[model samples]
Target: MTAAPSLDSKYYEAARPRSLGERLTGAARQRIHADFLRLCRPGPETTILDVGVSDVINDAANGLERHYPYPHRITAVGLGAAEAFRAAFPSVAYRQVAADCRLPFADGSFGIATSNAVLEHVGSPENQRLLLAEMARVARTVFVTVPHRFFPVEHHTAIPLLHYTDAGFRWACRRLGKEEWAQQQNLILMSRRRLAALVPPGRTARLGRTGLPLGPFSSNLFLLLTP
Candidate 1:
């Protein structure tokens, strides 16, 4: 059987200048960085488990370690290109993991666990839940960020409204001679309510909004869950 596309594969790379929407998204990401640091309070001795590594070719600031104060204590996990990623960022530890299995880490192995704009690309809601549960199991606090469905334009395709409403959009793109984009089936747009429901019950979840001014309808959503 053919293997699924890895997160570090060239299929995910977008090497271009930031669009107006992307610049706005970047602003929101900055807020997420600050909030994660504030909430997690990482120190030189604090062990942080970063569930997904960022696209080093596209945006350098997209990774958690970019804003993280202590790089020596951060360990990043990814599903591909571990050698290249490790060589590029030698200071941080890198681990390769299977896409469909449990994370190979002990319970409470780290002080904090985090992922950036990674939830939507994990395939389905079930896979997303598995990732969340693993993150929670390995750390006392979890900080994750995913694209908000209410955002006017989808970050991956740069298409507005149609992506959220049209399930056959990828198929239509293929018919219209855009075959490359049609292969992106992993992205799943999520709403604030749906995102909130994914959090474990009784946990303190503070949802933060970032981007252009519609409040919850912002471009990105951040979920900060603490024990």
Candidate 2:
């Protein structure tokens, strides 16, 4: 049997990341917050669930509490130990759960659910579907963000070549000495197309761009779906 891929959690957090500018720029940050507001349509009555939230340095959950308009409660889930998340978010509610596994919440428990650049790491078609399905099942509306496959050199992955092709991503990962995990490209590519089917069969998928014009396909792709 092939040995499981080992990822350096600390290294992954340390590497200069692509979203740094988005985190640093006030205007960029506002746009993201605005887009999230537009996508989730959160209101005083709305409840939000942020899945795959990490607590280490540069974690998205760090400023999330401040980004969105307050008056609503937010729950965050992460792959890191739940205790770690609790410590980081202190007053906010949080949960630590496997990214590609089942969620710990009850069915139809939330008003909205959002995940930013998270689905790509899930690494399995079955698990991808499970994750999306869980999101749809629990929340009235679901919002997901992913790096468009066409996005250029967004970051290095297990793939050796960096042009967004499956082979290229695999090559990059291999170069990173993560060939075992590199094969997860299937999940990334699969996510781009398959997310449309996550909503109720009759609902249509709403695609939102990052409002950037570099290309018809921006590095960031957002989807909002409802029953």
Candidate 3:
């Protein structure tokens, strides 16, 4: 990946001193990983393309990288620098994706394609739809995940119910010193209806909840789609 030295400054580039949020997030991801394996049932030779992998230096940050039995079969792409990720999982091929969030591969490039907690960061609803289309374009099976808006605590800022509305959430984020997350392009809350509309036409999209199941108020949302 051609990430500049400056790019790694923003994310968690260290292993020690992990926060409670990161720890909990990691545990949730482990559950997601289990679900992924169960649903996909990938064989040893099955290659997976993991879109929008984080460069955060934590054991729990990239769940598949930390525990996957076949690391070499994974190809990960992201916008930020991944020097630490490369060092940690040398078997996985890491690529620097552009800000447009397009996957640079042909149709059916991998057996399966996946992205975790990245839809919110891609800007608008239109952009989110495009991401879904691209992932579907490049793989036979697509699995994507995003945080639920009603999760009680906002995943990015860790604030409570102030994020129930768009205007109020932005205002509160600025007041609470989370100015970065205030920007819609940086972070936007997602609901069940919002996520359901993102899948392109003709695809059989099966939406599910994970982390905690509280009917409409779940901790996370996942999409398992097929063309």
TM-score of each: 0.82, 0.75, 0.90
Residue pairs clashing, model 3: none
In the range 105-165, model 1's lDDT, one tens digit per residue, is 9999999988877787777677787788888889988988877877776666656666565
lDDT of 3: 0.79
Q: Flag clash pairs in model 2.
A: 158-172, 158-173, 159-169, 159-170, 159-171, 159-172, 159-173, 160-171, 160-172
Clashes of each: 0, 9, 0
lDDT of 3 by residue, 1-227 (tens): 12343543333322234767767677778888887898778889898999877666665577888878999999999876687778888999988889776789998889999887788778888889888898888888888888899888777677788888888788887798878777877667888889898988878999998765666777789999876
> Comparing candidate 1 with candidate 2, which one achieves the higher lDDT?
1
How would you encode candidate 2's per-residue C-alpha lDDT over 1-227 as one tens digit per residue?
A: 00011232322432335555433332333455678786667887678888766554343333455566552478887666555446555656776675455788897788988776567667666666777778887888888766566654333242322746667767766677756545563335523466555444644579766533345545466788778
Ranking by lDDT: 3, 1, 2
TM-score rank, highest first? 3, 1, 2
